[model samples]
Target chain A: MGEFHFYTKLDQTLLLGVKAGNAEELLAGIQIVPDSSIYHHTHRYLHQHHYLSPEPPNDFAYWTAHVLGDVVLGERLWSVDIVGFQSIAELRQTFVNILEGHLASTRRRIDCAGGQEFHFMASRTYVLPTPHVAHNLAEFAHILNKVSINSLYFHVFDAKLRLERGENDFSRWFRSLGKTELAEKSSRLDPYSHTLDGLRREIIAMVEKHGSD
Target chain B: MARIEDYASFVGQATIDELFLLARHLEGKSVQNVNSTAVGGGVAEILSRMIPLLKQLGVEARWDCIKGDEKFFATTKKFHNGLHGVAVDVGDDEYEHFLEVNRRNAGEMTFGDIVFVHDPQPVALIENRAEIGRRWLWRCHIDFSRPDPKIWKFLDQFVARYDAAVFSAPAFAQKLSVPQVLIAPSIDPLSDKNKELSEEAIASVFERFGIDRSRPIVTQISRFDYLKDPLGVIQAYKLAKQRLDMQLVLAGGGATDDPEGPAIMEQVKEQASKDADIFVLFLPPASDIEINALQRGSTVILQKSLKEGFGLTVAEALWKAKPTIAGAVGGIPLQIAHKYSGILTHSIEGTAQWIKQLISSPAYASKLGENGREHVRNNFLITRHIKDYLLLFISLFHEGDIVYL
Candidate 1:
């Protein structure tokens, strides 16, 4: 596993994504570099953890891995920047390339605002690496069968993928990702992510384990 | 002194005197208004004018918002659909989301001596009755004669607990165990929308927008929500334009709680693009004076909402004596008395028919405007609204085991 690092974005330049416990304090203490822009924005203030800023003259995987890598693997970070590309097709291409070999994983933590919080985790984050993602839903299901579904967060950073976030309930589909391998294999075949036969069987087993409704 | 009077003169002396008379009875009582958003919608717009007027009248009235996130607002948006009789397949989680936001608001907001909770957004705040001994009223601003059962069941639990539930129209009221009052929402005749604009102000607005005063302008001012039906307004205008060479201005903005507005605006644009006579405006929330000038500059005003709580814009345009043709829904019927005051139409075809009638027959349109202004003055002015509220608040103080309508 590669060791994680952080970097901050000042204007167009990536400084370092710092891993300080208090993002507010880290932002206040950091001084602006001379001849550099005095970057002042709420997004910069709110975003504390930065994993890696891909060097320029990079491909889609660099931007995709740079953006999704931290959000998928990292905990305690509010946002992950994919860094913009000339077109979304290029970004999708990068996501496909990264999901080819490595199965990424991250431990779970609670995300809270005000006084309310909930636990979430992403065990595996990957891309389909195939064409016609939506129309060919069966092929995508085949890929889901191979990967361990125990991950909390899974994202395919495409406009088509963005629509599914609304179509599928985040909390319910997220829990379905934590199923056993046999159940996960079966769930991949189910049309709906939340209501697959395999996902149901896994949920039944989970409720039994936790002794819940 | 002239400037002070100029601003103050908007609400005429007669209206101010009437407010003072009503204010003396309920001088020290703490009145709290609870609603969805402090910006955008008509309820909030009325409160913005009314709260300050109430304070000036020596009443301690304050406004509070029900806390909600994007997900919760989505649920409330569903509730709005259901309340207005739209068929929506809202799930159990959506109901839970509504309650969750209400709980947050109930925990945060201070319940006053007279808590006037407005609309379905904060209706569930009445659940905090054990902590509050004062009057709690649920003010329903939408037409709810045929609300979806799924939403009504969830809202009924909260509304049944209220001391009283006030609806805009008699038809809007449900058969509840508690007393029901019909207090229609009013427009501030002195607000920016109805205030007298100088010729210079009107000309400047026209010049900035490249609108020529030489041609007659047909305008519809509303938020770009589906219920307002901006696309229908454009279609009606095109139908009316075949006879008269007039320009159409569809000017509106969106509300924070209404996420579907931008898409609706896009649809309106797609439809408006077919005709060069049509101008679709995506105005910001603070363009009140701009709206005033638009209304003043126009020859005919239309508010063709498919479903409305009470179309304050109709009263606003009517108060300015601009002949309006509004849809006959919600509280619009109360404002538009057919041929006497303003014209009310049921369909887009009917709206087009009336628009042509008003445009060609200037004498008839002038007479309608003359009557419309008097109708607003007699029934729908803010003075009348403030008086009704004072009386309603006073009625809440009476001790009775159960008060009957």
Candidate 2:
């Protein structure tokens, strides 16, 4: 197998020039804001507040709950199982389904203040290759501990959640190296429950544990 | 002197290495930062620090100023206020003068591979973009949430011509055709204003400013501008002083011919009285070390702004691990996440209560300070800012890079 080349990412968020002051507009935006916009609203807080534990709420859920004053819908949207989605397209469709169901059952359109309106944004990320390459698990464990949180974020969260990769780069790479136990354990690790820093530590610990065994 | 490597200890060696790696793609590309002034205000202060650092990282970066007469500057100042949604009347001649100044500067100046224009003052330089044919980027440093319609309309034409626009916050993004990138301004942790100070340095400021070192101190360091609401801070201090025995020191820069500054100072004095505890010291604009000392020595820091842009003072205070209270406006909320990192207040009453509460609860205040420092350390430091900018410059070239949520 080729050496696992580490990569870090920096996102430059761009306004989509479309915003939603009301639930209808928000639903419409969700349906057609390109996959990147869908990916952005769901995952921005993860990168922004990477220190917060148990993960922070996504922008859509926050807006519905706080801005639109629909706490039930907010909770419902927040409780959406991100792990079940195969791709951002599926995730986007899931949001649409939830919003459509709410609008259908209640048939009430809620509008927020101008300042509180949801401005759909598309992130233009620069995924640059870093200097950390590991040909083996020991080298990978050593290099993974020191890579920036952005590198860890790209591998774990962005890979599985945004890129539609069924498993994270680490898990897939471990499996390619015939490390089945390591792959399963790494893939089983949930990213939403921990900050990127915390997630990095977790992955490091998992790799070291496997080595010791 | 301020090498990118200097940030290794503060932001880890990997973070600094990432900056070099990002800068590799832009091998021989040059970035020219053009603004109205060479010094003063946030744009200049940032460029003064950022230019050298960019060059040190092997990107050919230089800063240029658009020369303007008093009329031009005055018109631009009104445009600035208008961009912040302030009510300012500007005439046709004023707009024409602004264009003439920019046109002249464009003619005289040499354009780099990427011509970076900062704020509304030099945005009109894009008129010559077709002739010069360089990658043009407009960077808006102010909040555009409620910009005046006329001002926005006038500037929208020039803004639309840019290859891309950069804003300090997502709220600042408008419905422009250009791709708008959100890049927040940063504070240099190693700068005189934000660096670590000795115990004696903190003590010397209190002695020099006549602030009693025995009692706990409450501070709000900003200009005496009406938007900053210096009087509102004084009112909050009075409200909190009902029970707390703390000294309030309102320190900021002075030496401006603007009549409003002295008038506000007078109002702040009248509200606080000749009370020794209410020391309003107007230090020189370059007194970063003094400001750092004052922030470090304070018990609780308040930004208490009626309106603000980014509010780096709050970040400075937080970096010192001091519990802070700031108005939940502009980019302040991004710095203070409600009660977690620091307290965000809406009214003078709330500010007063937070002030009193934070002073009384030492353990809670300490935790908030630690959290606030961590927040700033993760997001607002200069190294991360430079890396973001480098990525931004690279993005201008490789517009095809995909997304990550």
Query: Model 2 over residues A84-157: C-alpha lDDT tens digits?
Result: 67798888888899988888899677787555567788877778788789988889989998888889988887
Cα error, candidate 2, residue B146 (Å): 2.8
Residues B49-111, candidate 1: write the lDDT tens digits. Answer: 778777877889999887789988888878888887777877888778777888888888778
Q: After superposition, which runs of candidate 1 have C-alpha atoms over 4 Å from their true positions? A: A1-213, B1-15, B36-40, B66-74, B87-110, B128-131, B224-226, B254-274, B398-405
Chain A TM-score for candidate 2 is 0.95
Top model number, TM-score: 2
CA lDDT of every candidate: 0.60, 0.84
Q: Give the lDDT of residue A188 in candidate 1.
A: 36
Per model, state how many residue pairs clash. Answer: 13, 0
